[model samples]
Target chain A: MTLNASRQRLLGPDSLKPLNEGFEVIGAFNPGAVRVDKETVLLVRVAEKPLAVRSGFVGLPRVVSGGSVSVDWTPEVELDLRDKRVVRRKADGIARLTSLSHLRVFRRREGGSGWTPGPALLPETSAEEYGIEDPRITTIDGLHWITYVAVSRHGAATALASTTDFVAFERHGVIFPPENKDVVLFPRMIEGMHVALHRPTTRTDFCRPEIWLARSPDLLHWGQHQPILCGLNPWESERVGAGPPPIQVDEGWLVIYHGCGPSQGSEEVGAYCAGAALLDLNDPTRIVSRSVQPTMRPAVEFERNGFVPNVVFPTGLIDHGARLSVYYGAADTAVGLADLSRDELLSSLN
Target chain B: MTLNASRQRLLGPDSLKPLNEGFEVIGAFNPGAVRVDKETVLLVRVAEKPLAVRSGFVGLPRVVSGGSVSVDWTPEVELDLRDKRVVRRKADGIARLTSLSHLRVFRRREGGSGWTPGPALLPETSAEEYGIEDPRITTIDGLHWITYVAVSRHGAATALASTTDFVAFERHGVIFPPENKDVVLFPRMIEGMHVALHRPTTRTDFCRPEIWLARSPDLLHWGQHQPILCGLNPWESERVGAGPPPIQVDEGWLVIYHGCGPSQGSEEVGAYCAGAALLDLNDPTRIVSRSVQPTMRPAVEFERNGFVPNVVFPTGLIDHGARLSVYYGAADTAVGLADLSRDELLSSLN
Candidate 1:
């Protein structure tokens, strides 16, 4: 098994106490983490929904202007409300959610084992009308930079935000166009150029949601995009995306990623699994080895039930010199941790 | 017995399933009601507590200001947090709460069997700094006049609000000062003056929280205060309070109220039971006859277990000619109902 049961910390939505007295932290997962000095600063994506009374129907609380809240509701029969973590609205043929998303940063100091919350980052621009989500952090030249998916009616686009203290942030506008997401910037410059791994969509392409490599002279402008990886194995026949920043090794660059199987059974609809691929040190375009099968798949109950069930999407990775800590969202309900030996993963890079 | 156990409807906070979606409606009891045309409109006091991840301690959500909330937590070692509904700071001292209460109105049309939720009424005014709870509705000539307890740090005071459509409300300022609660206005004015049944506090009085009567000409200015009844039997050795608006009957004004025993055991601390009494038609201050014992007590699991265990506080009643539907808060969790013959209760009154 690529991931083991030993030394795992599954931080569920319950892990986050009430944001304040009235607001609840429903989903505290899909976090972006970086080791900052004596702490692991986690840019946790926390989804907060308003509190309301429920009878035959439910009243959903929504934020109004001027710091006020208003409630809206739908009868149990009128709406097919199934999951507690999701707010779904049926359109055309697919179900969509009406609720917005925001991110809350948490700092877990080395000595203090628990996560302490910080101020919330909300969707401010029209590009982020649907709210920003699922950030991936890369610390370059001491400053921690976050690349997240900005969603709106236009589609999903990559946006950048940088912070040193995690309290204050500098916005760097949308880095990619619509119908694109799962973007991650390399921790350091490669061959004197900034490199980023992202998944781009092509309507007619058989292999959809494939990971690609792009080089940029500056962090903003990009060019020479090459399709680096596609869904190959049966476990990854549906979609594949880069997970965390590639870890540098003597052999090459160790890249961890997530993939899903073909949509067949209920468990396979969106079941996520983790895998690793090794890329050449000098030229990332050259692939050395790739895992033939998923290194890790959903196993525990926490990974089997959530807003989206049967999933384990790893996003945050920290090298503790001896062991590697993988921080991932368990079933899209909570932040989970799985530890692996650094030496073992390096030897089994394929 | 004054009450029968046939064909019951008990609603606790758990009955509110939507609130059960992402949050927990710890208590949905102590409701007030009035028959509006073919609909039975109920104003339910719902106490929602945010779900927090529990380890060594859990943070309790509390309302702050500007429609925002905050949390104050105590470690499990320092504070005794046994009850899922309540949070107590100390073991021996008066128990403190970590939740905020809000009121939700539900309209159950005569033809409709279940309660359909309406808009939620939030704590807006300064008088309702903490919350507005356990309302009693009196339909005078046309409009439904609601009198409820406004709780804050200052004290629990009596406040008034009138609604004609149940959609719009006209707030009438605080009618009674702090350290007072359980205010219910009479349906019809007697002696060309408005009469109200209330519960007043007297520190030196052995029978604390006794029912009292007051006369008002304008409904705002009250006078001629007189204690109507007090705790009598061992089942009600602690305190008693007026329930819903007294029903007008031929024998006299029939009143079904709640009482509690001495809070010596854990089960009895907040244990509430229902009782009945008859008062003079013209002079409500004079109790014609009162129940020698409790008419109804916590029996079902829903009534005996909740945020406050063993609590059955009756606050709403609907006359259906053949049978009286006594709607009550069960175990301080959900709404409950019990059917009893009108004639039986009148004859059983001692």
Candidate 2:
């Protein structure tokens, strides 16, 4: 079957308004998308920084104890600012993000082209003092469960929150603890258990960044973890993580994931590309097939250069019967979209 | 109150047998102790390494998939081996331990001075692939719950297991995820909840190593985390963690904890010392009083030099009416005991 491929930029940093007069939007990307009635809602991660950064200082923004955003300025000489996203202290080797992120809602009519931005979901708890980032949403029994990365002094942990409607949300503390991210829950329970895919980073050299499966009786308490997949091909040799909630197909579960490999021009940075995998229908933990090459790469100008270069981080996937729409973060700065025929995407995985 | 202080080495690396013919015990320390019937049971952490290392290579030991230990050899030139405990790769910057650790049982009769070594607790699950270390035991309702640091590619996570008798253990999986350790469970439930003190390390500069409180209805699922205590004084400024299960006293909960500060002679290494703190009786999260000065430091010969220098890491504490016993790992090479008057120790915290 022939495939019709369409790609475009959905939202850029310049398109969205800042949180306040003192802050500027640095990134508007990595949206978690789901269809609500007649409109498609996008929970976009908006990274913001203080508008006035001193000439000789680096301002680190965080949510303080009273739920107010605060910026702490450190002298430029004390920081190693080689990376655009992070600032590392020279003395203690401690690192902090250059900007803070919060989830903002965006919506578009079923057949409309233009999108309208709505209210933001800001950091509320101590666990999200730094930010809440890269949300992945899954609707289970009518409730849209949003899994996002909660950044705090403890580390980057996966936290869960749910909403019957996008306007009202209930926070459900942390599910997976620190040094973990990229958690995506399946749309429904598999064999009477809630299944999720997560990427837990390793401190030791024995393991690399790979996707693991966990089953929970309740979504809050996760256990029975098993390593399902790891980086195998050259394009995904460094790391791999689940992009969106897996979609059930006739053969099995279709999974879209992002893989980080060595960049073509830069040695220090990684080029993130999108790939596909299929898990067994009965047992989601067992892998059925995986793409030998990346399905999508940093081919466009928006994906090539920005706050972070050469990145196409897919975080949301929407299945529309015969077609699928993929929402991704472009170079950590703006949101981009890619649409492909469902049959063609499945055949490419094989 | 008149105080009587006595310190002595109970077990050293030379005294314990190695795990296998090819492996040699490098360190035997950091024990979790509890009273069982007429005897004191100690679960000592035993660190072991391969007997032979190539002249220009460093050996890293870890538990492989089939419950067997294996060693990987890497060129010494590619590793930064400045630290005796860790070897970091120069290219990728990933770090690994030089030795693998397992828990071994040591039994001593009441009022006895000798410790008889027994069966070892080896790494059985994938989570404990790098080995287990620093176990803390607290008995509640006739069952002894053991909280230990399970090291693997995933990082140093806290895992729980329980036993009615010390011989057989039922693994309860990981209660707290990676980059966390130093977990000590309270002997009994407070306000109908099981309380635990843990140290979850941070990847960012926002937080330092501090003791935090978490409550759970069941031991498997833990939540409601609150930061309790952090290092304040110079002698305990670098980091702090709970030593053992807190002893319930008339005034409050008396906690023994370890504090890491700058070493007297070495600028690169930290000196681990023991201190005391009192938490509010009703709310264990509130700090009542803490010691401004350490109750015990690395003053003895065994504590001053060995696998890791200038360290006296207290892992277990026992109360004997008017007297108290502090069991600690000395320089990560030997186990030492310190005796202090119960009344004097309580007064010292003020």
Candidate 3:
């Protein structure tokens, strides 16, 4: 615990009720940002769906002609049942793993949170036949733009949409296409173009996922793929992705990203946290400084237990000079807030 | 499934073994390097100790005060009961966990194939109160050095040792005083100094476990701390630690590390896997590439089960030109092999 900060339940369990009912309001892992009416807001990727059934797994249970159940052989997908190398899910389905069909958002209204729920953003494309997840919202000039993961059989692809207010969003179609997520745009104009951070997933032996800097004159079409950050280090030796929008720190542009490590057991997916890296304000890809550790984690029950556990996603950040407030989703269930000083975050990175 | 090129073994109850002698072998995570002969090897951190009686645990049972065998709330520590985490024989004082008694060689002699046994290194060390576990071996010039997690009641610390042969070893004083593991040395010397990767656990508002780079002229003394990688990704955002010895590629040096994501109910940890990163050969601290998905995971039964299951630790890597023969310990039990071509590993990092 190098970070000795007090924990506060800024948004406790069931704080954003009614609107958040029947669904989990979790941080989108990578939160997107957009500015409208002079106030900064977040496009939080909130996942909400029905619980799934797992009893019908291949080897866990043998179904007879009459629908009787008996143990025969173990299932291949049930990799967690036999070994401790992977995380195992409850076959009964009583235990909630994650589902696809749903996603929503949480906006900061009137400079404060816990306001009346705004408009709900749902998936509108076929690529997200399963559902859309992990939205990264960025605004250019007056137009609000969002890039999200559209999930279907083809896997997760990046899609784009725009909105002026929390309500009335105009679909901008799929911006980056499939196998991509974690898209964040730089505020203002860079060389008279929109610069965004995007990670495209490709199939390779090493599974290398890197953050690329892309520029777009219009919010829809992106060009000039420049490498911003690569996932090749001891801390994030495996996979690296982005989180939230890059905050304007004095030294440079501070962007929070996510890095991955290996798992310990069957079917168990590891956790995600917040890490910060400073990019050149003008270039937006050059590295200045980065946090060596995460800003937050899934330590509480709501964070450690749920459909998918050990997950603290930072979908948005609000910088208030000395204080920085971060709104994140926990355990794929509810939204939570964690605050720290700008000085504290910068000092801790060293 | 891309690694289906190697020999695959389930090695469950169906496979032959020293019956009832099954156990788990977790990665000390990132182990220290020890150069022996013309080869570089990793001193893997292994924790195989005899099981202790569970008398006070919440879910465990105990004997009653009466002579009869009744469920008791509180029992003696000396009494042996069902302990899931430890692998020991209560009847005899012998234990499998690191005792200053043994060290298994990653490179064994002939006839050392499937279900074969190899000789241990030095059976004893003056500094090892509980023996060495999870060793990270590195080679600088011709000298081979190993930094490992040495444990005693005083708490765990990183200890350095030098070895030229798989049989003999020379102990260097503790490189890191205490509360440290996941140490990897840069393959090449940087600025006439030895660069190493390490993580010192500290308590922060969020659990701050990060990978750091340190410089040392002498392998034992470390200075010039630089923050290289951060665990801010969604997959491994919880706590990121180092994994295997770094592999040198054309683009950069590749280091595989382990990360713990969000936890599940009743379980504080989740899945562990092998993730790769490319770093500057000269700087050693600058990251070049990273992976978004895991290269090797707990996909098989042996890789998924065991003492404290769900762990796949790759401590030894033998590069045979086109293929990388990765010898890994599955679920802390036995050794298994997987192969990935140099092309695949490099391409995945893109």
Candidate 4:
């Protein structure tokens, strides 16, 4: 039941090899975890940047027009590079990621401690030109459907892909449009309709970013959107999003989500923490219970320092009978795992 | 054929009465025009602000939770009101519109010089809490479908409403998601499919705003999105969007669209001008011809000043056999009419 006592650092940037000889792995985190037979698979988000160095310039790697990776160089004087992960052009106030991300598979035996890396998933379309990040996997109709954020010139949109075998995959085009991310599909149909939890960011500041529920006859087109949750507590005052696919339980559908708020040390940067909420079994739009405070916070060294500091973003959850294992990205640099008793976690929510 | 010689200021804020006793109309422009039984109907967007004001505070009027108009007052010291139309909170950098908008119907009989005001359309749903602006009407079959931008905390989304007689309307919810606007539906079915031109804004600076094409079986659900036009010329270097429904002509479907570029006097604000393009009759996605330079610019005195400077946004185009009448919002403060020969406009496209 003691979360911090059972937590461990699982994987770091050094755990995976770079996609190409000219690239260097900068971060490996935010994995979409799922149990595949006897093995535990993690679709870890691998962020990479060009290894070559150029004086007084920053390089942005992206998938070019011909499906090849190219680096665009910009002068350091023209950019406001205050953030390590993003560089903003001073002229137009437009931002570009310093590194490109793609999902890489890592697996281990059910009871093994050592993990092994497998074949990687690279950016394939114009929508994924910048990169794809933060995937969540849910199984439905004997297929593992993966939902992730696709970043490009258009915007950060949620895209769907499915796989029966981890070796090969089929990509389903964008399910949610621009300014949307953090999509988690339920494992099964709810009342004969496919259900999903998505976070849509408003273009204007009239509303805060919050979690919304949507239903579809087919997974491609979604409608009947209902705003479900908003940031209420001080720890989650900024925004909230669905972390992983919800797990059905006796009480209700247990949802593990991420809540972001103002960091204690900075005004510009936000601190991301994990929280829990319970939705009604039949009607997921109705909230049964929610955690008043974050269930887990970024306290350890790995979660406090890296590409982005002071963050704990959970994107995967695995239920092992009485216990649950939560996998999260630590500081946008490494992967971290935490264990908790299912009953204790459910009881903690008010 | 000579644009400036045939242009005249049609209406201004002084033309319409305020919604209530304590409010004053600020801008009455951006009317969606259509021909109905020998009468030219204009759905004018009327923006209003609280007339009663106090020192050192600004009042923002909106439809509250209980479906009543209320004004939230904020201290002037805590806001940046450099822009006459929008006020940004200094604490969080969130911006809110200074005025609220609603669509009002205006009718002008054939051969008449004056327009008479008719029934008004008010915000009735949560999606339109902030307001509704810039409506484009297209008649197909027996009903006239009106597409407008619904602004709320959720973001600026395109909402569909249809009217049989303009006295009663049926709301069809949102057809496109957040960060999208400027939706113009085709008059009829295109190859057994309903076609539309929309402009979706990107969340990040990775891409410039451009016009896109989408098709639907029904008016409520839209899909098959394709990027059809982008800001290609210097006059349209910032963004471009479909202004009115494309008119079927001999060469192709004649499209009148709005394009924005850097203003000569200011870098912060852009100058909006109108341009023309030709799309294939069968395939609306193919660009047959386009105007290299803007066909119409903000040249007149009324178009160069007011709530928003340097704006001449065309929202309605009516074809009258050999001639066309263009109704545009000039400077976001008044309506302007421009008459052009159909043949001359088509020949102007490159």
Candidate with top DockQ is 4
What's the alpha carbon RMSD for model 4? 2.8
- State how far residue A219 of model 3 sits from its true place (Å): 2.6
- Per-candidate Cα RMSD to the true structure, in Å, reads 25.7, 3.0, 17.7, 2.8
Model 1: what TM-score for its first chain? 0.87
Q: Under the 3 Å rule for N, CA and C atoms, how many clashes does model 1 have?
A: 15
Accuracy of chain B in candidate 3 (TM-score): 0.74
* Model 2, CA-based lDDT: 0.85
> What digit string (tens of lDDT, one per residue) describes model 2 on residues B1-350?
12246889999988888985699998999999998888989999999999996999988888888888888999999998877787788887777888999999999998797889987888889889889999999989999999998887766778899988788888998777656789999988999988899887755444457787877777776666667888888877778999989999888999999999865554356889888899998899889988888888888899998989889899988888788888999999999999988788889876
Give per-model TM-scores: 0.47, 0.92, 0.43, 0.92
Model 1, residue A318: distance off in Å is 78
Please give the range of 10 consecutive residues that has the lowest summed lDDT in model 3 chain A: A92-101
What order do candidates take by DockQ, descending? 4, 2, 3, 1
Candidate 2 on A144-245: residue-level lDDT in tens? 999999987666778999998888889998877656789999988989888899887644444567788877767876666667888888878788999989
Misplaced by over 4 Å in model 4 are A1-5, A189-193, A263-268, A281-283, B1-5, B188-193, B215-217, B250-252, B263-268, B280-286
Q: Where does candidate 1 stray beyond 4 Å?
A: A1-350, B17-22, B54-60, B74-95, B202-206, B268-270
Query: All models: lDDT?
Result: 0.71, 0.85, 0.54, 0.85
User: For model 2, which pairs clash?
Assistant: none
Alpha-carbon deviation at A293 in model 2, angstroms: 2.1
Q: Estimate, for each residue in A1-350, the C-alpha lDDT of model 1 and write its tens digit.
A: 36553535456667666543455666777888799889887777766565554676654543445434345665555544554433344321112233446788888888787888787777776556556788899989888889887764334557888988888888877665434567888877888888888775432222345777766666764444556787778888777888887878777888888998865564325689888888889888778988777777888877877767878888888878677788887777788887877666666655
lDDT of 4 by residue, B65-136 (tens): 766788888899999887777677888767777888999999999999899999888887887887889999
Report the number of clashing residue pairs per model.
15, 0, 99, 0
| C-alpha lDDT of residue B316 in model 4 | 91
